[model samples]
Target: MALPASSFPTLLFFLFLISHPRCEAAESFSHYCSYNRPTTPAISKSIAKVLSALVSKNPPKRLNTVSFGGGKSKVFGLAQCHRDINATECKSCIEDATAQLPHLCPGQADAGAWFDHCFVAYDHERVPEQHGTGF
Candidate 1:
């Protein structure tokens, strides 16, 4: 059986907020956790915390981004907490999404997720276009 996908407009806001890669910086109005491996242990830990909450079913519903180590060209990701999700629920959804990505993508280093809604993947391509977001 196949699962259906959903989109949260909040994600667009998340994307809009993004600029360069500032793994160390965070915003109060948003919840962004990133893992910058090969350096920045603090960042990795921050990311882990968010991931843990996500899988546990307590997602922030504002989990806007999940970026991997940029040094790994094939590694990068983006996930949005469900708009309707409360902080706790959003965390949970993202955790599940994060865990499944590696297995689902297998070998592919780059993957993006639409929490409780969609998951997009690409390697040599930019972020995958969301439904009706246009390709």
Candidate 2:
């Protein structure tokens, strides 16, 4: 038997939904890693510290900046989630971004990743201000 005309639109809508999946918060969009490699073990340690801090902090407003160590060994990091997403999603996205950065940009002095719901970056120097610039 043939389906009624009333069900055609509903069926098409479902098909479209299935064909075009929504972007997940943890889905990676793009990434960048600086050409400058870490010159000392201290900087590498700092990078790990800052990245760990970023994941542990879990900003309530969905944006955070973290720093570790001092002087030449200093490492700075920034994590920001899209305002549309909730805090839990923001946290999860940040976690994923942090986990991927080390593998995505190994030994680099600065690296960044952009995901569907958030952005994460770290550098030996201070990370650039991400506020009020429309990212």
Candidate 3:
């Protein structure tokens, strides 16, 4: 006979579970962060929007806001990807990274992701654009 029918369902189920697909837990996205901290909803929303329309992240280009909460909290952020990436690709990466940032950091003000062709960052401090590596 062809193996007991009783075990077939269990075996198939196990196989399905193994190959179905897996997503890293909310905690596992830490590898994509650096020098980040908790942020306000406004900041988070703003960053996410900028990231969504980026044509490139390379050259360490960034957009930030300062003097929040009446006069404290300065948002400093910089996102950089590979200089080789086209504007379209860079934009996509920034959008993707931004969408994931809030979820990855969860209320965090500062966060950054260095992808093969892009990088992103957001924070509440002075993000110096030293070296003139901006485009």
lDDT of 3 by residue, 1-135 (tens): 688989999999999989876642122223344434556666655555544434333324543222222223445555554566776665556566656665666666656555545555565555523223333
Quote each prediction's TM-score.
0.41, 0.74, 0.50
Misplaced by over 4 Å in model 3 are 1-37, 40-70, 128-135
Across 10-123, the per-residue lDDT of candidate 2 in tens digits comes to 999999999888964365678887876653799889888988999998768677888989999998999888888888888898889898888888888788888878888888
Best prediction by TM-score = 2
- Per-residue lDDT tens digits for candidate 1, residues 21-133, read 54431112212222222323443443344344335433333424333334434232345553544665445445556665544444443334443433333222244334332
For residue 105, what is the lDDT in candidate 2? 86
Task: Return whichever of 1 and 2 wins on TM-score.
Answer: 2
How many backbone overlaps does candidate 1 show? 20
lDDT of 2: 0.82
Positional deviation of residue 94's Cα in model 1 after best superposition, in angstroms: 0.2
Backbone clash numbers for all candidates listed: 20, 0, 12
lDDT of 1 at 41: 49
